[model samples]
Target: MTVRPLNSVFIGGRQIGANCLRVLVDMDAPPQLVIPDPDDVGVDSWFESLVKVAKELSLPTLRGARVKDESAIKKIRALKPDIIFCIGSMQLIPKEVLAIPPLGVVNIHPALLPKYRGRYSTAHAIFNGEKETGATLHFMDERIDSGPIIMQEAFPIGNEDTARVVYDKFTEVGTALFKRFVESLKRGEEIASTPQDESKATYYPKGLPSGGKMDPSWDEVTKKRFVLAMTFPPFPMPDID
Candidate 1:
């Protein structure tokens, strides 16, 4: 008997998003609809474009539709997907959108949830001198990165590793985790997840730190770590004086 692929709507952007989408296609379980980040165009030159990847694969795409918006929600609801996979986009998935998919909205976050629960997890991890950081696949709730985690895998952060390096590591580990999740669905295994410990949670606000300025008051080691955390090519390094 032939098994039917899961019906899914993909909401993603950036390199990791594109990579995850490719993984789905490779596994013969591509999403029914693709929603690339609205602001992704011309946002950055360094990362792969989800829009481009979707178009290249001839997958149906809806660009410029924010999930929080009623119109986008309606469009997604019409598809009647079993699940919604959201990755890489920083926009918060509202409860309205979250309720559309029966199985829940799955999100791939770059850091271990309840720890680095914000936009700049990799950078924050490096800046804080964390020896290891990891990726998380979780269900999306109203709060940012606060949902129960489906899967997580940690990897070491080297002393010489910068934010860019760690980010690549996240992409690798996170994408693999997502692929595993898809494979599980193919095998008809029930999803398993665990609620995060709120006491261990941490959050960082959106946008660059101190407007991307290096604090002169920081000691040599701190300054160095800060700079390392902020380093990514095709984007200017943090200003140091």
Candidate 2:
């Protein structure tokens, strides 16, 4: 059987990098090369995990990279991949890199997007007391997650669900949805996607306030919501003086 070609994958960020890598390998839809980001916490570890898997299949270690800024783009251009899959990595692809891929670039964001187009989507969902959240696979544009949606997999945000739990579920559903999407492509199926509603779109800047004063005077429901949102570990419980 002829394996489908997926070109190169630019992976980093938290679980997005590892989960995408895992699914690609599992579905045999892995790219010709992988651009790893060691700067991201545990990203290199994800690469190492895949390295072992690659060796077992008699494949070379996926390309390892640590450079940043223009130098990194130059190196990527030199590699000449036909498609670029962005899993994470804060670096944005310029027009020069986008031109190299006929398929353009595809990325997966951990929110129902068109809603959460920027950073801290998971935490935002918890903070806002959302009852539903999801992950989106879409084309990459100069704007954030404002691209056309290739697919989206949604999961319930239980009243008790923590941000960490929601994040994990996003990866779980995202990987499964991504596999189906890629398989359809390999079978010569045309992709059908609807443009995101710009009117409903929202963007979150990085370092959005994760913690604030936790007032004991607040109602029980509001206090619980605050705890749910801030308990994700990175945002410490507000210091009570």
Q: Which one wins on lDDT?
A: 1
The TM-scores, one per candidate, come to 0.94, 0.81
Which portions of model 1 show Cα errors greater than 4 Å? Answer: 1-4, 42-44, 207-211
Poorest stretch of ten by lDDT in candidate 2 = 40-49
TM-score of 2: 0.81
Candidate 2 on 117-178: residue-level lDDT in tens? 88878877777778999989998877778889999888999999877778778878887777
- Clash pairs, candidate 2, are none
Q: Which segments of model 2 are wrong by more than 4 Å?
A: 1-4, 38-68, 209-218, 233-241
Model 1 TM-score is 0.94
Model 1: how far residue 120 lies from native, Å:
0.8
